[model samples]
Target: MARIRIAVTGTDGQVARSLVERSAMTACDVICIGRPMLDLSRPTTIESALASIAADVVVSAAAYTDVNKAETEGALADLVNGRAPGLLAAHAYARGIPLIQLSTDYVFDGSKSTPYTEDDPIAPINAYGRSKAAGERAVAAAHPHHVILRTSWIYSPFNRNFVRTMLALARKQDEVRVVADQIGNPTAAADIADGILEVARNLIEGRNEERAGIFHMAAAGTTSWAEFASAIFSASAERGGPTARVAPIASAEYQTPARRPANSRLDCARLSRVHGVSLLHWHSSLGPCVGRILEQGT
Candidate 1:
């Protein structure tokens, strides 16, 4: 088979970097465009870059990810996360290719106790979530050939994520205070990358219209942030790395500019049933990543 060309936004993001790495192991080519060449904040750049790239599929992985700062920088977040995706979808539609937009679980208000499904109504409590919700709408409106995959609690060895932060803090301190109230799947970026590839391939090769829709794809299981930290430390300890005692705290105690969902757990059944993809359990993916960070110090 001919190598599939996957055009992605952003170069340094965990998902984009992981996609490039994962594509190397497959018959797919990742063309990552970002920053000076293709900034999400700049609409003209997104258009020009997508127009020029002869890709089989496009993945919009970059976004204004600072949850707290987004409360203050709502305008920038709106432009990057809200309006940019429509342009990506419109361009990809013009070329008759599928566009995949990476979204978040923050779109929900966290009122429901169970895992969120694709049909859940969005009532974002924060600026970042609102912006991402807008992007999802724009992508859906702009093109029929779009897949909005909402993921949660992304971590990897490549970028500054929860796992790396926890490990680094363990190096400096004995006990770590983490919020235990907010629960979600601690998805590995590597797993998200692989899932993205599978979904893109289904759309690209099979032209599977069933795959072009919103889907939740997260790590198999769920845990509170504090518990996730404890699990990470446990994995680190096995590798003779930095270990820490996790002090579980409430969301009220550890406040942030953005109010996170109490329950960010996503039901990924549709992603599996439609695209034939499912991520490993949180701990299963997390252990290897923790081991890598501990060993390589990435």
Candidate 2:
């Protein structure tokens, strides 16, 4: 049997880094292209990159992830997050390859009491969310063989994420205030990448298309920003890294340029049924990620 060839975009980002590291364990050949190599700003580059590679599957992990900054740079965010992945989907359609695109929980306004499912209506409150929503629609229109995985509050040891931010503050400050109103799952990049690979493998083998669409892939448990920060601190403390107090605050206390949803929780039931994959609870994934941050002195 020939090993599956998978081409991944956004090699420089956290999710891409995790995919590269994890793909080595599988019987798959991973081809990773970074920002300059396949810049999202140049949508044509997405098609060019796909045409240049001979892969059974294409995974687009690259995105404009800065939510607050997206308000000021909406056009740039839309270009990278919306248009680029659309081009990749089109290219994949032309080549008869499966494209797996990463999306976000920000696509929904967080008005739903329960976790948002794949069929939930999208009404993004922020620029970044809107851009990702656009990307989701574009990919669906361009490619029939595609998986749009909507995840939330992703963190990894490799990049600048919430876990790192909390650890850094705990080291420097005695007490840190985190918003408790915004609720969502704290997904690990490694875990999310694993789910992506599962979906990709199924698609490549013609088993997952019946379940393909917008599936929410997040850690099982829901948590607020304050609770998540507390988990990070608790994990760090267990590793003897930092000892600091965490204070809970309302979202109104912290002012940011972009408006965030009070409830950003996602439902992964469809993801589980379709992909036959389960995510570790946020607390379990936090320890290793926080430990890495402590080891790296970040």
Candidate 3:
């Protein structure tokens, strides 16, 4: 049996790297591409990059992820996050392969008190959210075999995510202020990588044909930024890493150019029911992630 070649974008990003790391245990040949080879901002280079790799599957994980900066760089964000995934999906569709694209929960306005389902109407309140929402629409329009997995508050043992940022701040300061009002699940990159691979495996094995569409894939539970920070500190303290007191503050107190959804929780029932995939609880996933981060001392 030949190994399934998986071409992934954003070689340097957390989720992409996690996929590469986990590929060792699977029969998938994960090839990660970034920058000059597969620049999202340079759409013309995408087709050639895909042709050069000739992968059995493509995972579109690269994006302009700077939420606050997206406000000032709307055009670039749109180019990278909005238009690029669609073009990549089109290329994969032409090759008769599936394209798994990573999306975000920011597509919602955060007004709903409960978890947002796959059927929820998108109404992004920020530039970053708008860009991601556009990408989702474009990919759906361009490819029939596309999986847009909407996740939130992604962190990992690698990369500059909230966990690392909090640890760094904890080492430098006595107390770190975090927003208590903005709530969402803090999903681990490794869990997301596993979810992506599960979907890819199903597609490869000619299973779950009806599950080719959008779904919510996230951690099992939700928490505010402040509580998440506290959890990180608690975990770090237990592991003898940098720990600090988290001062909870309202969202308005810590203003940003981009308006984050007050509630970014997502319902993963469709993913579990359709794909038979579900992630660990946020706290359960965070402990190991923080331990790895501390072990690396990055």
Candidate 4:
């Protein structure tokens, strides 16, 4: 009879925007709330802001996402990434609905040689990672019906992600230098949104009670940042859009305030095995997104 209602936090972020767009194909409503209505930056306002919302599940897709900036703005990052999620979980617990908290792969220290599993130990090496790790704890503590998804290298046609950045740079520069040492899945926001919706569907329908914990939900394949950039340009070139040569470089050459993991690739087998949801390969998902970005000329 009635379609399910999936309430998501944040409005403009890549994941949030993609979730709204992706929901059109499903028989559920994705209601996105952010800013003045759900000021995650100010954790004190989230309770009052989200008081009137009604939904089958709550998705905490909002957070302090500036990794490099987070080094100096640790307190602000903690407030938005840590305390805000706990408050969201508290609301979800109060409402008796499932809470889907969007987490990051940066939670791991990236020292492990293989792709990380859900059970792997969390040892965040940066302020942003620590803040997200804190949020995971807070969410787990506050809500029993919660799914913490750890994904990586998110890109989309809708936002200021790596995909868009690469395309924009190709217009001005002939060659772009990207790190080749750091490895992870180059996940599409739309793919992530689809996976999230499926998880929400399972949670709302009460199909799998056991799928109530952390899960890695990245796209299937893995590659270095430089390789990912090459894929972007290859697809862009095929579409007659902007294309550039990706100059592979070491992580040390392009140092930033945040020290990212050497290997952040997530093992998404748990999500596939438990919820039966597997996202498309990173390159497969990138083609259409590149097409869309070319069409819009953004």
| Alpha-carbon deviation at 71 in model 4, angstroms | 0.3
| Residue lDDT tens for model 3, 67-179 | 99999999999999999999999989998888899999999999998999999999999999999999999999999878899999999988779999999998899999899
List the global CA lDDT of all models.
0.92, 0.86, 0.92, 0.91
lDDT string, candidate 2, 105-205, tens digits: 99999888888888889999999999999999899999986788888898998777888888778878999999999999999999987887787778877
User: Once all C-alphas are superposed, what RMSD does model 4 give against the true structure?
Assistant: 1.1
Report how far off residue 190 is in candidate 4 (Å). Answer: 0.8
**How much does candidate 1 score in TM-score?**
0.98
Off by over 4 Å in 3: 207-209
Candidate 1 structure quality by residue, lDDT tens digits, 1-298:
7889999899999999999988898989999988898988889888788877898989999999999999999999999999999988898898898899999999999999899999989999999999999999999999887899999999998878999999999999999999989999999999999999998888877665666899999999899999999999999998899999999999999978889999999999999988999999988888889888887763
Clashing pairs in 2: none
Off by over 4 Å in 4: none
- Against the hidden reference, what TM-scores do the models get? 0.98, 0.97, 0.98, 0.98
Of the pair 1 and 2, which is ahead by TM-score? 1
